[model samples]
Target: METKNMEVIYQKVANILVEMIPEEWEKILLYAEVREGFSQIYFYYYPINQKQPVYSLDIVDVFNIDKTLHRKLKQELYECFEKLWNEFKVQSQEQLASLTYILDNMGRMKLNYGYEDISEISSEEKQDKWEAEYLV
Candidate 1:
């Protein structure tokens, strides 16, 4: 694939991430370039308190660029976005207890059913389940 095409895809991914995590939009930084005939993309999100930036997320080793992987990557990116959005909402509501509970339960859920399967679970259901398990 051409570098321009890869850059477009990278931009799309970055846009999706911003839309999903609006709170982190200002904090997020995206960089993409072609190195050695391969596309390289980076995602960085820095917190307000942190002096040094942190590399909290990434998608590396992207060699074979195709439509299938592009679609799958978009889906996976959205799944992660939804999860992060849910976490942010819970945290904003001052539901620390519920947040922790959900994190733990979601980890188990991921372990049992896998991340792809967990994506099928609605955001509301996730929130409700966490509330039931911990907030109540």
Candidate 2:
């Protein structure tokens, strides 16, 4: 996908997150720009800190170069999102709201150069039924 398209998609994903967990909105931060032909996208969430302005949360970085990578990146983004959503669903409304507020304001964070990959065992591999599973 094009850099412009990737940025648009990233924004949409961020908006979806904002809508789902409005209280945690402050924890969410997005920094994306086009450099050369690639779109460098960073998604972050920070903990709350009233005294100091800056806080840091987890960050996911992706380089979107084509439709395949774009799709992969979106899939990964949603998986993490789902995990957080489920966790928040069990919390009180007030607590949820507070968390969302912290997420929403996570601002001006930058990406580091090094990258790490998160790996998990495929369900099929775990079950020893490769044919029954769909590849991501």
The lDDT of each candidate is: 0.36, 0.34
Worst 10 residues of 1 by lDDT: 105-114
- Cα lDDT, model 1, residue 84: 38
lDDT of 1 by residue, 1-136 (tens): 1234433433455555444332322254433222122322334444456544334232222223344655566566544334433443445532111112011111121111112223445555754553354332
Candidate 1 stretches greater than 4 Å from native: 1-13, 19-25, 35-37, 56-136
- Misplaced by over 4 Å in model 2 are 29-114, 120-136
RMSD of each: 18.2, 18.8
TM-score of 2: 0.28
Per-residue alpha-carbon lDDT of model 2 for 1-136, expressed as tens digits?
1244434433556554444331333355433222222233333443355322222222122222344545565555554434433333444221111111112454332222111221243333432331132111
Looking at candidate 2, what is the lDDT of residue 11? 53
Q: Which candidate is the best by lDDT?
A: 1
lDDT of 2: 0.34
